[model samples]
Target chain A: MKKHNFNSGPSILPQEVLQQASEAVLDFNGIGLSILEIGHRTSWFVEVINEARALVKELMQLGEDYDVLFLQGGATTQFMQVPLNLLDKDAAAAYCVNGIWGDKAVKEAKIFGNVNVVSSTKDKNHSYIQKDFSVPSDNVYLHYTSNNTVEGTQWHTTPNTNLPLIADMSSDIFSRPVDFSKHSLIYAGAQKNAGAAGVTIVVVKKDILGKTNRNISPIMDYRKHIEADALLNTPPVFAVYVSILTLRWIKKEGGLVEMEKRAKERADLLYSTLDSLPVFAPIVAKKDRSLMNATFTTHNKELENLFLEECKQQGMIGVKGHRSVGGLRVSMYNAMPISSVQALVDLMIDFNRRNG
Target chain B: MKKHNFNSGPSILPQEVLQQASEAVLDFNGIGLSILEIGHRTSWFVEVINEARALVKELMQLGEDYDVLFLQGGATTQFMQVPLNLLDKDAAAAYCVNGIWGDKAVKEAKIFGNVNVVSSTKDKNHSYIQKDFSVPSDNVYLHYTSNNTVEGTQWHTTPNTNLPLIADMSSDIFSRPVDFSKHSLIYAGAQKNAGAAGVTIVVVKKDILGKTNRNISPIMDYRKHIEADALLNTPPVFAVYVSILTLRWIKKEGGLVEMEKRAKERADLLYSTLDSLPVFAPIVAKKDRSLMNATFTTHNKELENLFLEECKQQGMIGVKGHRSVGGLRVSMYNAMPISSVQALVDLMIDFNRRNG
Candidate 1:
């Protein structure tokens, strides 16, 4: 039976990408050396990394003004690195804490400098986006998460800010098109939409660096990373290779425009099923609901357990909700086929029919 | 023809390990989801990571007093983190600079607190280890590299120190038995002896943490990593999984004792060949020579180029010396077979017969 996967990050990847990545692991480009053993500085790997970086620029429609870096330590590290490189001792950065990830980012940023919480939906347990907030003019940069993987709320529009904008697009980077011109830095942990678990992709405008009064550690320094072209040290080679194959797949599937279309179709189909059933209630507000991760719950515990067990028996996996937000979450990343969403919708319908 | 891989780090891995890792990438342990798509928090991955950590302790003969962590950002991150977590503003740390890596550790350590270079081999261009050094009693910790990858040198004996001992064993962790009781911490980049490029293995005494007065960043703090069991964030899941497989393979192949015997055999064979060939000269002193990487040179550039071209034609790879060294380096890490060293020796013999 074909399994329908909904794992949050380190989620579903396209079947073809998985096949190609496995093959590369065995014998990359017929070099007789497993990709696992090849040096990061080898010519073949250098090409693979460059192509991956180029694809990020092409898909985002960003020009040469932006620099792309493949780094280690995921989005969690970026929570500290962004503030380390950009914030001065006396200056402050603006952050909108709409969900768990945004709050975590704010916490990390405070260790470096003062952080202004411009907006927050914590009062409602992050069930909605706080959109009517001001971006402070005194801030050095405005940092926000484009989508909250836990709460299933997304920013429909970026904050209007004159200060340099930094966004952690960890969960929804290539799922839709965005105006890249407004952001000074955009970083995503590749496990969600891009590729694997090891590397983080950062798209940064080089001009915004070198302004911090604090001495940034060399490894965490954005200016040093930009100058070295992201090869200042041995990178995560196999992960970067996997991300490259994923970028190639993204290009073949008609880029972000097509991605947005499929995303809407999947989210609409699943959301409509929930709306039709009284047992299920969507967690986030309609305007702020995410197209990537769909969160919902049946307030009755016994019914929810039964629904989850039935879905599990029918080859559906990873539908259990985060413990903080107990219910259910179905993550439909870019590589998640629409057929999987259809399978999930069918399972939900069947469950509702037997218990409605 | 089967190629002999000798790239220094990210060098070679066992054939069966490669096959199993590739298969897991497709379908992990009969789970319908590919390993690439499995969440880090899933039960299967939890088992993989836990077993990997346990194996490190088992192989090192460490007890409950130590904490084993698999982290991201490689050993480069540890250079600063060791100082960040252990050093206070008033105290100084001691470092023995033997080669490029040890020097790098010292440089990063200086960023956090005062560093005392008790001894250095820089005057000899790192061709030998500086053994005559006194450990400063007041120092926070003593830092050194176990094996110098670029210079082809390894310390036969660790520095005698009453202070806490820290080692960058990036090239020689599993290749031999170590006095684990002597060191406060040991860290290795996985690309060399362990497995892949994305993850790092860290073993530290739990008592040494929480002593630093400086407020270390959560991601860079050892105490936080230990508390969270190295899942402080989404770890390098794929890299950690790969390391688990490699560790399993090491156990199957008779563990460290077998590794040491094979390492000695391969290094002795290659070094003997260099000794016999009038055209070649070994770079490092005999006592300090590395079993992992063997560095040598020919005075005539033309002869060196021809020998490399011949090796390439015969399916021998990664023998080119680092550009800074300007000669030849044959890295024989734990995974490199004795047969590969024999083949290299045979080629050198044939080349000398013709060119002499």
Candidate 2:
């Protein structure tokens, strides 16, 4: 059976990337040693981490002023790391509470400094992105999740803010192009549009660090990591290697411009089908719907499981929505082909016709 | 070419584990989903992390009171997290500074609380483990590196401490059995004796946590990770899976007892050869030498590179020592076969004969 992977993340990766990653595990670059066996500091691996970092910088169209680091503990770790490094004690940091991830990021910031919630969509079940947020002067940074996987909403525009903008691009990074040079820092967990689940890519503007007078633990301090060039300690070697492979694929497929075209195409197909089907409806505000995760629910809540069962039978995996948001979600990352979206659309149409 | 792998971790792993791990990257369990492509919360991956955690407990011979967590960030991250969760601002942590890792642990702990140096062998270049030192009674925890990879020393016995005991067994874990339940906390980066590089195994006595009362960041707090069953955030899915396969290999190979036996056998062979050879010298205190990493240098410093060149010619990988400790280190972990040890010993004897 040909299975279509629609799981939100640790989601889909390009086929060639998977092939190379699999081979490397057994024998890395024809080196007698498995990648699992090599030292992190070895020339082969240093080249890997260095190349991966360079690729990120190139893809984001950023310059020498921005440094790329491959850190561990995923984007969630960044939730606190961002505040721990950037937010000064007594000075406030601005945050937007749009979903669970954003909410969690806010909670972590509160521990380090006063958090000013400049915007929130939580009041409406995070159904839409807030547009009129204002970051107060003297705030250290304005933070928001660029895409909410659970809410199935994405901020297509970078929120207008003068405070050094920080975006958690974990779920929708590489699915489209943005003004990457504008943000002071952008981070993405590799599980989504990148590669595997272990590494987190952090792109930070070099000048923004060391201003917080707090005695930061060296590992948590961005300045320390940047000074060492992401080799301050042993990194997650295999995860970074896979990220290199995935990033290479993204670049070879004509960079984020093409990724955006494909993303819009997939999202359009799924959304147009949902709009025409009276029995099914997208739960997120139409303009705010995520290009990565397409969330919807049936007019009859009882039919959600039945539709999921139909999806399972058709070998469509992970179309079910998050437990928090009880609906169906079709996650189409950059690696997701238009055919997979068409397959899901076909299922939805078939499901709606019979149920209606 | 049959290569002998003695590189330090992300070192050697069971050949069978690599085979299975590689295959799963393409298609996991005949499920048509690459392990990389599955959602972390899905039942398939949940079972992997659970099994890896359970395997750690069973192999350590600890009961259920010790909760195992597969966290991201290497054991280095635990340097700060241990203090963040265990030490209060007023309470002090007692540490033994045996190597750079211990020094780092001390530095990170100082960020959270007062640190008392219980013992230190740095005065003699970390050539031996410090003994006959006392940890103060009021200390939050007595911390030590069970194995110093750089200095190449090992603590054969757990220190006698009335304070809560914590061990960073990043290099020597699973290579030997000890009174594991005696410690309040034990952590190891999976790259060494456990599995791959992306995950770290944290075994903690449940009662030891939640006592610090110092507004610990939930992610940094072990209690939260334990509560969520190592799924608090996206785990290193593929790394944990590889750990599952590696742990299963350990159990199938007769658990830690047999592993310890093999560790002794390999170390005995390598040490005996070095002791007999007039051209070679083991740098560390003989009684304190690590069974995992055997660090040594040539009697004539000029011959060191020549020996490494010979090692490279024989298809031995990662034989170079860390620059901080400029000497050759042959790391023979659990998966290292005695034949490879014999090959190295054979080469050492042959070189000694020609050089002498």
lDDT of 2 by residue, A47-78 (tens): 99999999998989999899999999999999
Residue B46, model 1, lDDT: 88
Task: Summarize candidate 2's per-residue lDDT along B1-112 as a digit string, tens digits.
Answer: 6479888888999999999999999999999989999998989988888788888999999997899999988998999999999999999989999999999999999999
| Model 2, runs deviating above 4 Å | none
TM-score of only chain B in every candidate structure: 0.98, 0.98
lDDT of each: 0.89, 0.91
Clashing pairs in 1: none
Report the C-alpha displacement of residue A175, candidate 1, in angstroms: 0.5
On DockQ, the leading prediction is: 2
Candidate 1 lDDT by residue in tens digits, A1-356: 55888889888888898998898778988989889999888898889888988999999888888999999999989998999898887889999898888988988888888999999999998998887778768889999999999999998897788889999999999999999778999999999999999999999998898887886678878778778877878899999988998889888999999999999999999999989888899999999999999899996999989988988898888898986788999999998888888888887787778888
Candidate 2: residue A340 Cα off by (Å): 1.1
Docking quality band of candidate 1, CAPRI definitions: medium
